[model samples]
Target chain A: MSDTMTNTQATGGDGAEAPRGVENLPMVKALNAGLRQAMLDDPRVLMMGEDIGRLGGVFRVTEGLQPEFGTDRVLDTPLAESGIIGTAIGLAMHGFRPVCEIQFDGFIYPGFDQITSQLAKLTNRHEGQLSMPLVIRVPYGGHIGAVEHHQESPEAYFAHTPGLRAVSPSTPNDAYWMIQEAIASNDPVMFFEPKSRYWPKGEVDFSSSAVPLHASRVVRTGTDVTLVGHGAMVTVLLQAAELAAAEGTSVEVVDLRSLSPVDYGPVVESVRKTGRAVVAQEASGFASIGSEIAATITERAFYSLEAPVLRVSGFDTPFPPAKLEGLFLPDADRILEAVDRSLAY
Target chain B: MQFLSTDGVFSVSEQSEQYAPYLERLTEADHRRFYRDMSVVRAFDVESANLQRQGQLALWVPSFGQEAAQVGSAHAARPQDHLFPSYREHAVGFVRGIDLLNVLRLLRGVTHGGWDPKDPTNGNFHLYTLVIGSQTLHATGYALGQKLDGRTNTGNHETDEATMVYFGDGATSQGDVSEALVFASSYQTPQVFFLQNNHWAISVPVTTQSRTPLHRRGDGFGVPNVQVDGNDVLASFAVTAKHLDDARSGQGPQLIEALTYRIGAHTTSDDPTKYRTQEELDSWVAKDPIARFEAYLRSQNAPQSFFDDVDAEAKDFASDIRCRTLALETPDMSLMFDHVYSEPHPLLEEQKAWLAQYENSMNGGESA
Candidate 1:
């Protein structure tokens, strides 16, 4: 190891070459670091999925992993999402913590049947006698300027399943810490990594106090309104909050790390102070995570509400082309529009 | 013993003696009971298909000719043993004690999972899995858990547990199936991989799906493999019983391929006539599993009352299915948010509130 990168420090310590420690890495680099750390920490940790070995994944998230870890630990699997997950179940049973990658978000449909029906229910079906210690990493959401099926947001489908826990990370620190947390969890976790934000750089504190994957984080605090988002949309919500502040409005931003077993403490607390909220996502507005959040805020924080909780999300239409994606995605403008509407009410 | 056979009569291998005691334990009453279960399940299957045709059900995967394979294999499993079934295992679901109406609810699109796999009433059998070969790995993993818990073959037949997973010939080509076999063999998990090679997987024929046979694939992974006359209930029962015993006894995994035919469309959305010929359908009809089982029962001096009782029970069961299916109501859309998380989620709660207001506003001030 280089002298500059020797310590697992959150910040650089009087070193010229070291810039901001691990936190300054991108989401993809943070993930690579996290996987390496987990593998080094535990002998049982293994990675398996299509193109995860030689090809280093289509996103190059697993780039150079096979050469570093060897083929036995980092495996290149056959082209089958269902097989990837199904086999991961077996590997988990054999005392291996298999972190599987389902090449893309849209490609996971073939494996969805196994995930919801088998992987999710196995532990509960056996009354906790069997715990599927597995992680299914899916590159989800629109914004890569991809085609029709490739950019779909299907987190609600996995989150809806009973025995599965779904979690997604936004920043580099959360990405690094949560990936380790998810691997340590005995429950099956659908780790949805935002495909669009993989290249965005952030500060990751590897040795910093690690947060629970199931807990929500209060990214930025404000009082006028609570803006809730997760995965790639967290960055958008932050930008919206910044713009809102410039316009003489206060916005509290909540990055929901966990989709299933969602930590409502932060959200409820933020909303209690703010008295208004606007949930945002890249998934369709109809029957989405945003829809779920909007309902919960009304029920829990009904008396504190100055207006109905609004949602700024993708339209109830298919994810459009690369050119129209800017219009299709939930941006700062759309989020601000929802904030304006809620404040108007 | 007709097509896909070298002799006029199907032969049982000498190794099959291990299952002879269990096979002999099945009395005339047991045979009649299995027949009745198959009949009722088949009735429900047909009714659901008709319901789909009438636009009541969104889709129905018919379990017509594969009834004997499901019934026999399912019967071989003890109550303590768990099952992981593919979507078309109606007869297996019936044997596992699932309410026939619940199966219909899934086809009718009223519920994602019509019954709870963990419910005691479910008899340790999981809900149907629509994805092709995924359940095999789950079953294997669960069996590994059973072994870890020291619950396998405790010398108490009633308490000892094994896992049986159902899939099809088409699924044999899936990497999940092969990988599942590899893990099961390596861990020596108490799992029985039951493959019902029902001739066709959608439009692909069995010939196109595999060469050198499906059962042989299991042997490559070190799992003991066998092929049975799927239409023959006795063969299916004897074979499944033996393999299930081997698994429960800690002898590792086994693969059982039941040779049968689909006899109907893959699902209500499919049209078999467009791809297959009338002659192919007629050939499988001659080897109808239910008919052969009924004939075998008659030859065993089964009373006429047995047939009459089974038919009457099947009719009542079919009537109940029809009534319950038509009377089924769509679940509250908000209920979708209920089970997403075991703990209370603010996100879901907020969404539910917005939906309530949205629905109320849509209905002009009435809650849904």
Candidate 2:
């Protein structure tokens, strides 16, 4: 589950190093590998979260880390979110790169001020005299159907903040590389891990990454339409792309790995060729990542558009009961319908 | 418990006698230095309030009657320790190695932070946290870091580190404060929570903030706690010195509730006359920290010339601060985008460049 880049092809954009050794792992295992490698590389890298050490987290993403890295480096912190984040900021100021885990997306609100006000503003407040090299790993999004407050997509809250970096990984390989890259970064990063994809095994090319942590990638190519999304919504977008292609729609799917400071290069290029686009997300459409992408695409590719940029997203409401999550979350059918609306023009 | 009387006589009661040895560590030079600093900060506070009244500053947090608590506790901590201050620790900053003018830069609206704590000139005093009680958690975390790094409990006060966080009584009600105390006790971190119960949180009384004595609040968290007469600078120094020594020796976190008073308005903008009667204010004024220490100096047969010299030095210190503050220039517009992140952020960089170009275009048009 844990493998490092062994230097196959130093510079390529996609996972084409099949001749190189690869591992089949879930996003959880991939993230574990990435965190382990980062800790091994730097003595300052530490992991602190509730139940992260002894219980290996509620998701078990931090299993075997405490025994290997020792309890001092991998801490099972007290059950307090604000304390975890607040102390982590102090730890960062004391010259440690702390990667904190939020048990769930909803639990993060308890630590919201430390994250948004203190952690986000410390570096800027110190006027560059200090650097907050911290990572808050949030397991988010729907399709798990465990309970209320368990499944959510709150990346927009962090993405809207100016001093914080927000990113999500849609695949195992991206999870492995992006977590490492995020750890290596000197700024505070909100690492939104899609909980629904935690169990799905995918190809993790430990040899190299397809793109930089902040860059978006066109996972599939097409000529008629471009579908853009991030995290769990990305899998739904790919499913919709496959369905649209069956109907001869030829949809291109773009994985928006980075939420804040979004890399619109690949998405804009694909939309230029396709002449239409639909942005989807599990988060509510109003004032969300999906809305931002649609607005930006319309501004940058106004002349090339075949239609107004369409959005397929969660309804603007609190995540309903687990039974209603199916209707609430954007699926292949909802995205295909938005694709139909975009293609109509 | 009070160790220094309001008449400036130094004595130890049964409860405070244990802290008496800590005072022996202080030389006569330290005693004279404490009196001098308390007077200097009082002068600085009055001049800063005047500056705000003259519209030179946007607002001012007066440290009028709380100087003894701040200065004494500040001196107790070693150089290796980190101090996280609330917005009105002017006396603490003065007793520490920070230039008193940097605090004015914040009130003057020229900078969010006046100086870098890492800069030797500024000492190890971190930035002022206005949100209240927020810095307690930060200080606790810093203590945890020291503990994890094996920098605490080394039986060497010179090498071992501790954290001291200052907050007012009103901040104790904040959830972050409780969380910080919990974390500190749970981790057994080397830290001190210095709560300046100045009797008033703006208009609300300390009675509104707590039902029990504030020091015992730490008892609920299982942290060792004590209460002292905050106006007695000698008592403050002795108690703080003992606890700080205990914490560095890996005795876990300690809490000190310093009972003091706020003689002036909360800030320059507030009207204390609106809230309280003159009798209440006058009684606290009688226990003024500077006057009390002056009495002690006189009891020790200190010369009138020495008192006159201190008054002269205080006037010079305030006048110097006034001159320097008037000389501070408005910050550059470009600095607004700087330091948002340590690395180059594409979005901020582009926005900064666009703003510069837009401003330049406007300037060119004006010239034409």
Candidate 3:
């Protein structure tokens, strides 16, 4: 195991089981545990979404919550995405902290107007008289061979908009701590949960949060190259780092927890040391997160760079069919190829 | 059907008997007050339109002939009730205690929104929503919150809270309106959808916006609805009073379609002469809500001094806008960064600081 994984495992608290700490859990279960803790911590925290009550959500991420919290707190909203988001905005105005779920990344467009125009602009329009303490949990990205409208990476759309905080956790531990922190935020947040990382098991420390909500962390340290990515792309970069080490090349990996207000502190510090960098993502490269990170690194650490910052991301096209998602998504091989190219220069 | 005819007579037949008791709730003083409000709002409306023409305002949305419908329905709402208005509800906002100068600020291009709805001075009226039919969903959501907060359906009509949202004929076509109706019906929220079917939405006639009466549109969504002759302020007040009571008493959502007319251009930017005929405008102008209400007040033995006092008050209100409006200063440029996020945001903070330093540099001042 990488030193970062080993450290996280040792300090990890028990998921579902607390004080004594947890051994292992999938990212989805960690999120469930975090949600329960938030509900226990604050009565104002409530949830609303389609199929989130009895069905416990399509991915079972919200399983068993309705039974524990009751129907009023854990609402099974109508199939209308716009209504769900729109009403959640109202609920927030009335002093409730609502965590809404958009069933799929592709299905979120129905609520796009509410999210971008109303929810995003309301706090600004109110001139800070009202605070929208709400979190929109969107299960995004592709890895499962699901059909059309099942998987997407639309975080860039929100990150580009002001008055919204966009974030994605790459590990079970991060998911557990970050979700609670997001719920505690007084401003609106777009919580982009990686669906592909839902079933992956990892240690979660319930004792304390490892890092701030927006801080980027160096997961694996190396002297030659720095690899930066967020969400599921962080996992691919880590894997590529492992393979790169086997070939006698040193590669460091950074896990970006917050997608917006992107700390860039840790990223710039790492790029300054390594002198070369590669950023990866599952989203299309055009005006995407990868393009942004790469540009900033070049601007901030121009003299330290030995090579141009490389980006390994999906091509500019539609999400594609389930069978073709493998080709469309970035994997360890694609990231390694970029790393090798950066090392060559 | 109208309980008060254009000739200023209150004629109640068996068909209108249910609404008579609601009229009994109002006194002679209330009748005179409604006439005063209608006249005052009409004068203010005319002054504002003139301001727009003289370049004192960026634009003006005239409430011209929709006075009775606005005044009556606005009075029907209890002090605790929350109201969401479309752009042209100047008379309603005035009734709700929002400083009319704030509304002037909005049209004067000083701010996107002129007043803070949370301030007690602004009353319980929310901000004006320029997007058609958008406020209906907000009002519905707020009604949902009211239900969840246990403010509604508590068996006490006077103490219970309700929400009222105003939209127009053309806004009925918006998807948000349909969704609001669906959610309101599903949740059984204590609310009222007050739609002003003013004969035109810009250049589009009511016939173009809907094939059926707008109130009937509520029926498909399972909300109990009614159509009132909006030019008759008494009918407007009585019908809204009953419906608001029903909503607060947990009878669920109600829809009141006030059949009225917009006797002016949609905005200062619009020219009604391009699309509408003079005959149409003259016909609606003859059925003016303010004129009929004055006739009704005079028959009730209101003194000529009452008319003189209102005219004097309205003239002062117009001059207040003309004199004070130009003196309203421009907002600070830094206000742009002040409210984008409620919390301390790193990016905005950085940008805010950067702008300050840049401005200082331009001014040949020292920068820290």
Candidate 4:
């Protein structure tokens, strides 16, 4: 289920050497490998979460880590989300890079106060005398047919915070590299893992990442309309781009890697070329990452437009039951329909 | 739970009898130091409240009644140990060698926190946590780090490290406090939860916050718990010394419920008269920690000159803080942006530049 191999690439100057072969692994396994590699590299790296130890997490993303790192390094904390995050802040103050796992996106609210009030502010509160080099790994978004709390996209909450870094990886390779990069960062990061795409396999090279974790990548280039997506929605956007291409729309796809401090440069550049864009996500269409991207594109590329910037997102309703998830989720059809509306202009 | 009777008599309880040796070990110098620290903070506390009333500070959290609880436990900690203080532990910070004026910097709205724990002069005393119960988790986490760093469980008291976190009764109701206890006990972290049960969380009473005594709350979490007469400085010192020694020597976490009272209001903005009875305030005043310690010191043959010197010194110290506070300068506006993150962040940089440009444009002139 998991494999670790060297990344065959030139060494990065700051000692980020992929220094062998890419491991084709699922997103969960790739994340595990990245965490394991980080722990192996830095003594300060530690993992804490509920059921993360003997149970290896509800998602098993931290599987086999407890045994490999020993219980001291891989702590199975008491069932307290606020405690996990609050204590992780304290541990970070004590100079440990703690990666905390929230069992589900909904369960994160219990720890939300710590994340927003304390973890987000400690570094600034101390005037840089301290740094919260912590990563909160949250398995988010829908399509797994799980209950109310399990499937959510709460990136907006973290992204809106001034001091915290929020990022989500849409693929296995990005998960492997980004988790490691987030842990190595000297600031707190909300690493939202798209639970629906955890099993999707990709070539995760251990060699090193080509760009900084914050940079957005153009997964598929096109000309007529640009389709912006992140996390699980990026996969759907790719499908929409392919569909639009066959219809002679030639839609470009941009995977927004970092939601906060968003790499709007590439998105802006793509939109300037395409003249139109549609941002998509599973979150409801109210003050969401989709709304933010649309706003940023509008601000940066307001004149370079064929039509008004549009959004294809989940309706403003509580994430519906498993039976209605397909309708609730932003799929290729909804995205291409948005593409049609944009192309119609 | 009481080492000295409230009537100014030195009498030890059975539970506190175990700490009798630590009391005996306290030299005249230790006693004088405790007196000096307590008096200094008390004077400073009074002056700070006056400053708040005079519009010099935005607010003040008075440590008027729980001096013994803070100072005793603070003195119990070794220099190597880390301390996490809830917002009102001025006496504790004083014992930890922090300049009392640094606390005013926060209440005066001059800085979020005026001192850094990493700076040696601040004495490893963490910045005060205004949010209740949050510091306990931080202390537990830091203690866990200490244990992992092999700084604890070494038989040597001087070498082995432990941590102490202070909070009030109101904070006990928070989920974070309970969670911190669970983690501390589960991880066997070398730590102390020094709860100054001051009987009020603002206008709310301790009775409303707890069904049983607060000390027993930690018992369910596997932490050894004790309650001491927080007004009795000797009891606080002895009990804390023993528990901290035990924790550092691998005894894991301990909870000390220091039974005290908030003689003053919660803050300068609070009116104790509105919520509490005059009779209750009078009763707590009668059990004042400083008065009780001063009486005990007199009974131990302390000279009048020594008492006069301490009182004079406390007054001088308070006056110095007042002078320094009045002379306090506002930090650079750029500080707000300087350390939002350890490394340079593009967003913060942009914000900083925007702020600078906005300030530069204040005179309604275009950029050169």
Query: Which candidate achieves the best DockQ against the true structure?
Result: 4
Best by lDDT: 2
Query: Lowest summed-lDDT stretch of 10 residues in model 3 chain B?
Result: B1-10
**Residues forming the 10-long window of minimal summed lDDT in candidate 1 chain B:** B1-10
The complex in candidate 3 yields a DockQ of 0.47
Candidate 4 residue-wise lDDT, B1-368, digit = tens: 88887766887667777898888868998988888889988999999999999999999999999999998888888889899999999999888888889999999988998798999988899999888888899999999999988988878888899999999999999999999998999989999999999999999999999999999997799999999999988889989999999999999999999999999889998988888899999999999988888888889899999999999998999899999999988889888988877776787888888878887788575662
Model 4, span A305-339: residue lDDT tens? 98999999999999898889888888899998888
TM-score of chain B in each prediction: 0.94, 0.98, 0.97, 0.98
What tens-digit string does per-residue lDDT give for candidate 2 at A237-340? 88888888789889899999999879999999999999999999999889999989999999999999989999988999999899999999999999999888
**Ten residues in sequence with the least summed lDDT for candidate 1 chain A:** A1-10
Model 2, stretches more than 4 Å misplaced? A1-20, B365-368
Q: What DockQ class does candidate 4 belong to?
A: medium
List pairs with backbone clashes in candidate 3.
A13-A22, A13-A205, A14-A21, A14-A22
**Which docking category, incorrect, acceptable, medium or high, applies to candidate 1?**
incorrect
Candidate 3 lDDT by residue in tens digits, B1-368: 57888877778977677887888878888887788788878888899898888898999999999999999999999888899898999999998898788888889988767788888877688888787887788888888889888997788877799999999999998888888888889888899999999988899888997889889988899999999999999999889989999998888999999999999889999999999999988988888888888887888789999999989988888888778887988888667898888778888888899999889888998764
TM-score for chain A, candidates 1 onward in order: 0.93, 0.94, 0.94, 0.94
| DockQ, computed on Cα atoms, for candidate 4 | 0.56
